[model samples]
Target: MKEVVFQASLDGNCLFLNPAWETITGYSVAESQGRQLLDFVREDDRPCIQTYLEQVKTGKQSSDHPVIRLSHKMGSFRFVEIFVWQTLNKHQQVNGLSGTLIDITDRRQAEAALRESEERFRQIADNMEEMFWIRDLRERKFLYINSAYEAFSGLSPQPLFSDENAFLDFVFEPDRDTVLRVFQEVEQSLSYQFRARHRDGSWRWLRVRAFSIQEGGSPSRRIGISADITSILEREQILEVSLKKEQELNALKSQFIATASHEFKTPLTAISSSVELVRYYLNREPQTPFTAVLTKHLNAISDRTTGLDELIMDTLTLSKLDEGKIQVCFQEVDLVALVEQVIVANFTNREDSRQVAVSVLGDPVWVTIDVKLMSHVLTNLLSNAFKFSSTNPGLVIEFSEHAVRLVVTDQGIGIPEKDRAYLFGKFFRASNVHQIKGTGLGLAICKEYVELMQGYLGVDSTEGIGTMFTITFEK
Candidate 1:
């Protein structure tokens, strides 16, 4: 049998030598003789070599896993992992040691690159706003979820993914079946829109896209991203409502143009006939009996024409207000005088004008307002009061200070509570008050005028008792 060769040394400088080492370093046995082992090691690895030598000198089992760069035969460094063990003398004294070197540079580089790739993936998942998730399809459990999912859902992914049924429970009831169906069709496609409950108890529209990970000819994993689309949904709803309002306004404008043309023509025709009669009759003989009657009929025509003119002016004012084109000039004006003028203009025919008492209270002072608008406001209120209170002859209009108050108290049938809310709305008439003829725009126009003057207008009524329309202006 051939004898096996071994390398051993007592001095640390001439540590271990082997035929394999000489072959690897391109040094013959004779050339390596008497050379310090440190001389053959790479300069940067000398310290680690010394440490391992010290451990062997103490007769201890030195750790073999030493990451060192060693000199190759071509004078270049070779990265190696070394495992060393100590040899002991018969008397338990330290002698020498043996070690095995394995080149591991390629394996180390691959491991380092893999670690960097994983770190990059982690950073992206943490920073994304969209919720990201991965699930083990075979186990029917979530394997990972990004931070955004926890923020939106008010729950961490751990418990949700731990139990297969937990994720199904969190899905909105209406969307559960759809989600399941889409998930089952993962082999075909894995993208869908669905609603999910948010942390704030609101629902969010989410677009989810996913793909299946196949293993061994079967789907084993799934990955997806979920994005919130709540704002998009809200914008769509707003656009829908705005479009509906624009259509309604267009229809209203068409009807208004037709009604206004007819209303104006009727008054103009009456005025024209009266003017023609006046011109013809004035040329007739004096003291004629028909003169007084014709004159009286002409005056009646003038009054009706004036009333129609006022109605047209009111409608124009309302249109300007709607278009935000009316410029109000507010100033201090006497509330008492304003109310008195409205009463006289609307009720000059009252035979018992003295019977209607007008009381001025508070500072009897002036309030900031636009007088023209305020006059229209008072006219609407007083006209409504007179129309509703012809049976109750003693109608009272009152005024006060801190606010200019007008109480058009009547003994007429009052408005019901249910109808009060819509009283100030355009074209609204009380159910009981419909028997009387009106444009149904008086109170609504009154409200707009009052509000433009920075005042409030309202009505209080009880069916069968009486109705009181009140206007209050800030002093």
Candidate 2:
């Protein structure tokens, strides 16, 4: 913002210095008036400044000056950018030089600091073993990715970024659906393990995470990382087979799960898509018996398909947790909004949206949890509340400075006394609720999940009154 105006003779002697020059260079107009312009310039820069003035003086250049540093009255040099042009007499001959020197010391220093900071970060990112990336979710393109990506994948990012789906082409076909599914669930940050094609003609396991980035309270982009987890997956594969020939049997169980999940997901995704199409067409048709019937069936298909997708994911999560293969990513999350979302998803099929009442008793709750896993835990509890309750279900969230507590209460047949002791055992179901269909893995998975998040789960119930599941975690 500083500008010092000056007029100089053909030989570069200062003939005039404006008042602004005194404030910038710490030299009064009287002291600067009769001095040579090059006398105040740094010795190293005087030549370039002189050369620029001479060029303009001979009409070889029009309106330009070389940037130079001037010695200040305080015995320091201040960087300034000069813009000079030759003044012309009425006869069109060069008369003198007129110019302005704008101080840019602070701006130059800032630019240098930024370059150093970027280099520091670049060094760290380049040497990382894991592949890190940031994507502009709005544009569906990568903003940045590290060198490790090309080193591991043996593929440059140029083409992959050019075509949005080009990266997916390298994913194993069976794992593609799950990968695409995760990207579409864009409301929250999530992570999962999947297999992808590697450069050495082998399949490698990758643990990838995606987080929705928000600006102004809305999603603006995504940031994610992918790490090679083949060794971990190999261990899981070995552990799944008989101990005698464990390593050799690596392919058996992993393939079983992958194949089973792929089969389950593929058909469900197709069914849901088809149902949506049918629903869209039916909406345009007049209200008739056949149309009503078709619409109802389509709706049923959509709901059932979604339930199946959840079931597949939950089962896989339980497997990972039991095998000690699950990786937790803890980050700050809005516990209240997460709980509210779970409730909304569960009650989507209900006649009244208020079937499950959620009461947040305290201030906005923020906690550190693996959002993907925590969401699964909350969804299980909330879904159970709605499924078992004959009347309206009640959810209470109590958050304090020291801790957070959530209580999900249902008004249906409670856990029998005998079953209460083994309620969390895998496949253990209460005898009274045998008619209700369930995997019996819900409570067991939830218990492991809550504990994994460094929290505790408890239950209170009477025979026919209800069951209230309580969760507690230190803030």
Best by TM-score: 2
Which sections of candidate 2 miss by over 4 Å? 62-65, 236-475
* Candidate 1 residue runs with Cα over 4 Å from true position: 1-227, 230-263, 266-272, 275-314, 349-356, 391-404
State the lDDT of candidate 1 residue by residue for 251-328, as single tens digits: 587458548856786868778676767757675758577877777777777766765665566566567667677888
Model 2 clashing residue pairs (backbone)? none
> How big is the positional error of residue 366 in model 1, measured in Å on the Cα after superposition?
1.6
- Top lDDT model: 2
Worst 10 residues of 1 by lDDT: 1-10
Q: List the residue pairs that clash in candidate 1.
A: 64-82, 64-83, 64-84
